[model samples]
Target: MKDTQIKKLIEAEKKRQKKAINLIASENYVSRDVLEALGSELTNKYAEGYAGKRYYGGNDIIDKIEELCIDRALKLFRLDPNEWHVNVQPLSGSPANLAVFTALVPRGGVKQEDGTTSVAGKIMGMSLDQGGHLTHGQKVSATGKFWQQIPYGLDPVTETINYDQLREIAMKEKPTIVVSGYTAYPRIIDWKKMREVSDASEGLMMVDMSHIAGLVAGGVYPSPFDYADVVTTTTHKTLRGPRAALIFVKKDARELYKKIDKAVFPGLQGGPHANQIAAVAVALKEASTPAFRKYANQVVKNAKVLAEELEKRGWRLISGGTDSHLILVDTWNDGKKREPLVKDAAGKAEAGAGAITGKEASERLEKQGIIVNKNAIPFDKRPPADPSGIRLGTAAETTRGRKEKDFKLIAKKMDEILRK
Candidate 1:
């Protein structure tokens, strides 16, 4: 508190967040208890390993804190202790994903002249610009560097994932793992179907449900727990927790679990953030309550109402509608004369609506206190620098107690800015 400059900036940020209409899909507001835990004295500790198995001393209490966090994570998520092993120590989702890959993939299968191990496998995930996260084996990510990326995209017209096509691709690629869930696509994922594909291809099923983890907890979204071999989720998104991630492994794979723990500790990270772990514990406890369930349900309700209102004003949403907490809207050239239909880089047809580029639309919205991010629509002709879609989510606003009517009003405000 003595640092006036930092304190002032933090205060300003709090005020700014209070006034901004937050719609970024990957963001949420944590409760005061969670915030307090984040700033607690636990920050000074360096717990290099799991509970009661640390290389560093003075970590007995840190062990208890982490154990509590992992326990709550498993309990809150309804994972049976007999069937699951949870890892709460990956810094965030990206590293959590990397840990999973390192744990599951056969590393050091080949050694080059440099005396370093070479890892090789196919990681099948959704395409990044088409709704996948970068860590899902995108060429630009390290995961892609280590493994061949076999990416999938939504059907150019319906905008839903073509599962038959996905299975065919999986059969051909014989991927080491198949990832479900996404960063931008709004429709619910068919986890069971993904599991089917994974089984058919003899691949591991990992659902990166970071965006919908809270929705899964609240019983709104389809839970991947029963199907995925590994489930990775960030605690912050719809979970309304700290910026931490949880990696869940099915109990049947005891061998894989051992590999995962090693990857998280000595292989990928060291001295896990005890304070963040404690905050994650608090947030997990909060997420387990009946009140949080109501909040999660309301988040979906608000998103639906907002999406409907936006559509009423000419915003064409991907997949026609959303069954989750987010919405992806196409916002490319509003006035361009077009043929009956448009095509993509693959010559596949796409159906959608008009002018302001996603970035320009976002800039205009920000000036009006509405926060959103530019995103690439499936087969978007425009480049990433200026994509054809804007992504929105209701998690933070719904957490602030906004409801269907509030979101409808927010949609009207967005209409005023984007309708031009």
Candidate 2:
């Protein structure tokens, strides 16, 4: 109430959110309870270590609070504490993933004859332009600098992951790990196959389900717990919590559990943000309710409707359609129905040299009070800054109480903007 400067900016952001049709797949709106917890007095605490083990004093209440969050996370996901060690201290997804890889693969490298060195170990993962996150091994990220990255892409024709090729590459590359979950690809990943590939290559498997944490909790999408050696996810996306993340280590690998805990505490972060953790607990509790399950299912329903409506409008959908809450559309040109085996002749004349480019479509849509992000479709010729596609998700809209009909209308709005 005192500092109107910050308060006014906050109010302005609130207004913008209220007025916009948010279709960003990686975003969602949290409830009032979650927001309250995020701004509670718990933020004043200085709990550095896990529950019951604090580096500073005055943590009696903090211990119980963190334990409650850990307990709720396990219960919400139906995980047995004996089999999985849950660490709720990660600041976010990217850091959490870095801790995992840093624990498994240290930063030391092999010295060459030239006195130079190369990062040891190889991480097999999806490529960024093909819908993979930067942490998965894009050169720009530290993950790539720390270790070698073996990038895997989708089939040019199908625009979907080919398990056979993945297995072959894993077997030959023999990477240190295999990452299963993705950022933008709108299809269900085969966790079992990924596990098999990891096993054959004598490597570990990790799944970043940050984008669909709520769906996994609601039992709508496939759970990676049964297959992955470790699972990392953010609480803020479909989970509808504050900005926080969780790391789940399989109990079968007790050593890995210990390694991950150490990496998170000493290797990466210092004292955890108790307020965010408290909000995560509240969100986890809310996600376990029956109402959340309905919301999760509806998210998928709305996405399917979006894809269907867009297809009816002659928009080309990458990989045909979506099985989750996200859809990727190639707006470079009239995707309609023709098989695009190459990247040329895609984005139209308006694009000049590039497709509508994700940036153009995004800006045009934003002008109409609709929000979305430009993305790269499979075999996209344009660069990452402006890819050949635009990504749409129904999580935020579905959370706003919009249903299938509303999503269909949203799809039409998208079509109209792209046309302009």
Error of 2 at 363 (Å): 0.8
Residue-by-residue lDDT tens digits, candidate 2, 1-420: 799999999999999999999999999999999999999999988898888778999999888889999999989989999888899999998999898998887465668779988558888888998888899877889999888889999998898889889889998999988987888989998889889889978999999999888999988999999898999998888888889899999987347988999999988999999999989999999999999999999999999999998876667789889999999988875333333232345543222122366788899999999999998888878888978789988999999999988987888777767765
Off by over 4 Å in 2: 110-119, 334-355
The candidate that wins on TM-score is 1
TM-score versus the correct structure, for each prediction: 0.93, 0.93
Model 2: colliding residue pairs: 83-251, 332-347
Candidate 1 residue lDDT tens string, 1-420: 999999999999999999998999889999899999999999999889789889999988998998898889999889888889999998999999999998887654688789886768888999888899999999999998887888989898899988899999999889999999899989988988998889878999999999999999998998999899999999999998899898999877356888899999999998899899999999999999999999989999999999998776667788887999999988774446223243577976554234688989999999999999999988888889889889999999988888998988998788778755
Clashing pairs in 1: 83-251, 333-355, 334-355
lDDT of 2 at 200: 74
